[model samples]
Target: MTENKIIIKLDKDKKKELEKRFSQIGLSMNDYINLALNQFLIQGKVPFEIKSPSYDISTLKTKKAMLKTEEEDIGIIKNSISNSDN
Candidate 1:
């Protein structure tokens, strides 16, 4: 298979940050970018959505609150069961 090269410019800081993230995920920058491009070509769009950290933190808080509410409800149900058994 013939190979082609593509060149693009990025901010140095952003490139460094992307390299760090790619390293953490055990992929080289070249491989990661190529995978993304291949996916975009096949799907006709970027494969993933970029989300803000604040959004992620808010979602986490919401999930925790829901879990706490469910736990409280379970405790109330258990108490009612025991009370009825008396």
Candidate 2:
């Protein structure tokens, strides 16, 4: 999988908090993205809604959406692979 750098616009405090959370799990942003992509291919669908965010140049503020990570996807992927053996 090809990896790319992403510049995220988030509050300093929230970004710091997320960095800490990611560090605790030993998952860098790229690793998390690859995991998500693997799940998407395994599931054969985009997990999140596909929408273009409306950007406001004048206000310099955009609507922010947070994606919650799923810990159960690993188990789900394992189940999918095991079931395929039947």
Candidate 3:
């Protein structure tokens, strides 16, 4: 069988994260990616669910409010960390 090469770019942090995850699962990064691609080819679609977030108004409002709360919490945590370092 003939082989070909494919080059893809990944963020350094993401690459390291994936390397760790695949290692825990006993697969190399190349092997995991190839397995995903092969499954897609055989199934004619991704091997996972693809769905859009429900666009109902209440859902959107709740999500937005939660995100804002999370942002505030993150800011507080950062400030506390910086204060501790001082």
Candidate 4:
């Protein structure tokens, strides 16, 4: 079989976090991808769910979009809702 290469771009914070988690579990990002690919080939389907992010409505952007607050800046931790719910 012919080989191929795939490139992926990740956010800096997410890359750091994933690296930490993978290290704790004795795995690299490439190892994880290979395992996932093998699982897909064995099962003939994707093994994980693709879900939207949960949104923080307390953030300034959300409030601004809703036009429900006087605050003009993103605030600290407050609350969150499922992206699917909105």
Tell me, by lDDT, which candidate is best.
1
Q: lDDT for each of the candidates?
A: 0.84, 0.63, 0.83, 0.75
Model 2, C-alpha of 21: deviation from truth (Å): 0.9
Query: Which 10-residue window of candidate 4 scores lowest in summed lDDT?
Result: 69-78
Compose the digit string of candidate 3's lDDT tens values, residues 1-86: 89788897999999999999999999989998899999999999998887667877788999977787787687843332244555
Q: What is the TM-score of candidate 4?
A: 0.53
Candidate 4 lDDT, 10-71, residue by residue in tens: 99999999989999999998889989999999999898976544554456567565553233
Give the TM-score ranking, best first. Answer: 3, 4, 1, 2
- Candidate 3: C-alpha lDDT: 0.83
Model 1, span 1-86: residue lDDT tens? 89989897999999999899999999989998889999999999999998887679888899877787787687843322244555
Q: Each model's TM-score?
A: 0.50, 0.40, 0.59, 0.53
Better of 1 and 4 by lDDT: 1
Per-residue lDDT, model 4, residue 53, is 45
Error of 3 at 78 (Å): 42
Clashing pairs in 1: none
What is candidate 2's TM-score against the reference? 0.40
- List CA RMSD, all candidates: 8.0, 21.4, 12.9, 11.9
Deviation from native of the Cα of residue 42 in model 1, angstroms:
2.8
